[model samples]
Target: MGQRLSGGSQLLITAFVHFQSSFIFIFQDYLEENSTSIYHDTVSIGGGSVFPQIQPQSRPRTESLDLNPESSLIVEISGAVSDKDRVLFTIHTKTTLPEFKHTECTVKRMHEEFIWLHNYLVEHDQYAGYIVPPVPPKPDFDASRAKLQRLGESEGSMPKEDLQKMKAELEAFRSLFLQTPKIWADSSEYLATFKKTVAMHEVFLQRLAAHPALRHDHNFRVFLEYEDELSVRTKTRKEKAADFFKSVSKTADEALRLTNQRDEDQFFREEKCLLTSYHAAVKDATAAADLANLQRKTMAENLLRVNLVLDNLVPKERLCTSEADLVSVLSSFFEGYQKIQVRLASDEDLKFSDTLRYYASDAGAAKDLLYRRSRALADYEAANRALDKARAKMKDIQAAEDAQFAANDRFKTISECARLELEDFKVRRIKYFQKNLVDFAELQVKHAKAHIDLVKSTLDRLRDIQPASSSSVMKEPTDSVGVPATERTVSLDDAFGSAVPFL
Candidate 1:
């Protein structure tokens, strides 16, 4: 780290840096060039996009995962100052639910780190362009250590009480980490700013790797000086270049594969096919129900006419037998027709038709999933390749150099695992859709058959019934009950329509 300075001293440094910048036209031009380069690098490296990597397939969720701030886990701390002005806090983690998992770890506040980061951001306003996340005031470590000494733990060894206290502090830190979203719940500006800072940093790294002038710049060196770990184990330009090249190659390959996968995806088209089939089925079912209802109404009307003819017009006539039989058959057919309508109304297939339409939208989502999965796979491959190149480069270098790229290998491993998990999810999703499609087809067949049976039975009943005697049915009745003179026979063209579409 650089020399720690008071607020006034840091202001003086910023002023001086600003003045130096004003005198350098060449550096100003370089900054402009670097800004444009940043956009290109952020979007793509070696003709392949890298950032905003694809994620794995998320499980279908019926409810949101957002946590209520008031209901979330929280860490509460109460502090008291010692004679040395050291703040010691008694901390504990509390959750809304008893079932919430808990683990404790060592907790050390980032008092010094906060100061350094704050001062750096304030001084380099053009570079940071964002505020640091809120950090708690520094606690007095000296006072805390003194209290620990008084607890009878000698030679830097910790007593059980001290260890327990440390555990509580660790738990507090962990709780705080988990509660970040809640802590910054009011505004997302912080996150946007954070992204900007990261992008800025990434741009700077790429510039440093590409341009020697930037590597030697006083301001650049000062900006990098805080990264003490990097200084401890450094890689040569050649090794860095090798890693970058390997990453670019992997990213390009992954992007290509993703594009191919997207183009080859049949889910969207299949979903459309399914929707069209379902739409046609719904129409057919609706038409069947309409026809049945019409037949029932028509039969009821005919029964009324027959009743009028038998009760008053032909009460003691032989035509009574034929009229009574007609009434019986019509009533039976109407009852059966009503049942068919009822079944059609409550049909699971009809209900499932809506569900099919609902899930038809999933095909679109599935396409998106494939896209995301492809991107994620590419990211994982790129990370893995970069790590591999780093490791290979380290093999020929000192152990210190190996330490510089050790984290790369870990990151790459995690990415690779994530990609594989996403791939597994896709496979599972495919199976799920396959089963759903089969079930839908079977149900559709069953429903179509029900409609066919209803129509067939109805036609058979109509054919079996005939006017008892043509002259008896046609002759006018003179009784008080008046029957309509219009013919009661159903027209095949009007009722059944040409061929029973489905039948």
Candidate 2:
């Protein structure tokens, strides 16, 4: 009778495990399909923007999207050093191109220099059709320094282990930020700033390098290969004011065009609407990801505090043997859990949040391309009207005709370039989001498995110390479905569901 009952129980557990696995698989499929469906539905609504939707069966192309694949120019931020109030970046360049003075060279540049390069690209009339990469943000470490200061102020009441951990982090920061080691100071802030800025600058240079026309730009070549400073000056107050008003005028023009003008081309019309919605969605996702990361960091800190308390309790000589063992195990568990949480948070920030933020900015650039095209269209129409009036008046007819012809050429050129840029933007966005999302999902699964293992091991240790009841010995930890936690496995497919398509 006992044997039969045990066999029956085993069968029931096996069936339950299968059911649970099926449920998870079904849920994952639902999420993948539902997300895609929602995006398509949202994009299908009437708007000026147009984007080609990725078919369910179609795979994103994996070929090099670079227009100038043969270009041998390489640029990198090799290192950076902080002066009293300024940070200077060492831009290392290597090229086999004849345009450069040398095959390899390095030059120091500041944040303002990077801005100068971006502004030059933006204002140049010849490159107006191209989607200029967004400017890299200025590196700021104020928040990091403030956090370190707060940590220092609380040092008197903090546990020794926590204090030591913070010091170790600071040391790591110092090593990353400076060529020479310095005393422990605002390491987290500086390290974060360095990583963010380097990533942004690298993306900016890579974008410029990949462009067929921009790569050959004389100013860009000088920026990369020139050994001396570019000697770009900061904008004067008058210039700044002019720039502000120019931006305001442009915004007003965009709004007016959005209301009055409708794109005749179906492709461009969908692209404009699609890009605007996509950018807003990406921006929201980035914010949510950042908030989640912040919460995880806070949780890790709390876990550290709990671990410290347990560490202190474990050393108490008055505690019983079982109590001491339990305390020690708890401390070890929390410490490991805290470390895993920190690592998980960092992975998500780097792979998910940062990727979303970057694409958000890039999407904005794409939108700007649409805006510029629209503006060119408006100019062409205005020129046509002016020509019509001149023909009616029979005065300055030759000049009016020339103006109309010029506007027509400019509009056609911008339209063609904008189409190519938008297509490339689509391909690049998909490639990046696919890679980053898959990596993030895999990391999440790996961390989750680690968490389960930690809990299972901790429970086993605790069970061994606990006094046995008359009923039975402690059994191995099992998940909700009654499957052993140690036996549970998550495959990449199960975790990632399917390839996510981006707008």
lDDT of 1 by residue, 1-503 (tens): 02223435333323322333232344445555653343353553466654333232332211112212243333322212122442222233333433333432112212233344333433442322121222233433453345445544552576544454444323323343345523211112222222222222222233232332223334433333322321222346997798699768756764676445432335433433454565466456546655654565455445434333323322233342433444444445444454344333333322333223323433333333333334544554555566567678775344434543554454344344433433443453455446445444444445445545554554454445443322221222233476534534433234324422111
lDDT of 2 by residue, 154-225 (tens): 799877877866764465555664554432222343454566676677668878877878989998888887
Residue pairs whose backbone atoms clash in candidate 1: 105-170
Best by lDDT: 2
The lDDT, on a scale of 0 to 1, for candidate 2 is 0.70
* Top-scoring candidate (TM-score): 2
| True-structure Cα RMSD, model 2 | 14.8
RMSD of each: 36.0, 14.8
C-alpha lDDT (0 to 100) for residue 477 of candidate 2:
51
* Model 1 clashing-pair count: 1
TM-score of 1: 0.24
Error of 2 at 245 (Å): 2.8
What TM-scores do the predictions have? 0.24, 0.71
Clashing pairs in 2: 48-269, 49-269, 49-270, 49-271, 49-272, 49-273, 50-269, 50-270, 50-271, 50-272
